[model samples]
Target: MSLPLPATGTKRADRHWWQTACIYQIYPASFKDSNGDGFGDLPGIISKIDHLKSLGVNAVWLSPCYESPNVDGGYDISNYRKIDPRYGTVADIELLIRSLDEVNIRLIMDLVVNHTSDQHEWFRESRSSKTNAKRDWYIWRKGKSITIGNECVRTPPNNWKSQFQGSAWEYDAHTDEYYLHLFAAQQPDLN
Candidate 1:
């Protein structure tokens, strides 16, 4: 029922640093707000570096801070390569990395690739028309309405439920199809 532990003597030092390092997770939006903007930015995290160092932390893991609609608290990313304006600029992130490195703190980012914001460029192009170049980038399916006791019932492609709420698929009026979203309607699963 239990897995065997690594050799405790000589093998202890051979293990990766992550096996023993204390990693701290920070949700940037709620961590610290710089510039009185009421939203956390890379600079805000940089300002707290001393606290992390004093806490004996080795690495810092951050949730998604990419450009997004924030429909799912920044998980619905609109752009993967750009930082959200509310979070600061790419230069600021570089500064944060350098600052963390000065204190021996590794920076880790949460990569949310299961799905993306419906407003993402690729999603927009995909939904623009069925013949679009990126139309196959996202899941799209036809749905049917079932008649039960005289009442017509329209449902998603399947009975899959969304983690956020309601059905896992949202009907696109323009595309005349339903797209799968494991979380919120704003986040459509990639094909």
Candidate 2:
């Protein structure tokens, strides 16, 4: 069957919009501010939908707005279900999605699951005790001892460096083990 062609000469069915769509990345905190709060909010994004459309953007990939400590610029999520107050309320996000939908613009959110905030419930429970049921959720390796100028010092399990320019593993005194953190010490890598 022949697919209908739009004014842009692109077939509706033959062309996957996701493959050809102009998607813009919006870091909400650095974007427009409608409430003069010095931080971008959902209403700010809503007001800029028209500007994005004018710029030929059909989709937007939004940065993390989830509840976090902002250790990694909101990438270390503490609660995936809750929206950070600095960004907006849950209802505000819903409104933003609906407003974008009205203008035929798709909204996408960033999903960072490589590691979560140490304050996250799962991480907290996992680190509560070595025998905890969720202890295996995060990688915990035995620390190694290295002599530095005749002084023996406990070191991480490996010589790997974190992306943030530090040891990839953090020593947890409570658990007496070194947990892998590809990013920040607060972000332990999930097992």
The C-alpha lDDT values of all candidates are 0.92, 0.91
Residue 84 lDDT, candidate 2, scale 0-100? 95
The candidate 1 region of ten consecutive residues with least summed lDDT is 3-12
Assess candidate 2 and give its lDDT: 0.91
Best by TM-score: 1
Tens digits of per-residue lDDT, candidate 1, 19-96, equal 788999999999999889888888999999999999999999999999999999999999999999998999998899
* Winner by lDDT: 1
Superposition error at 136 for model 2 (Å): 1.3
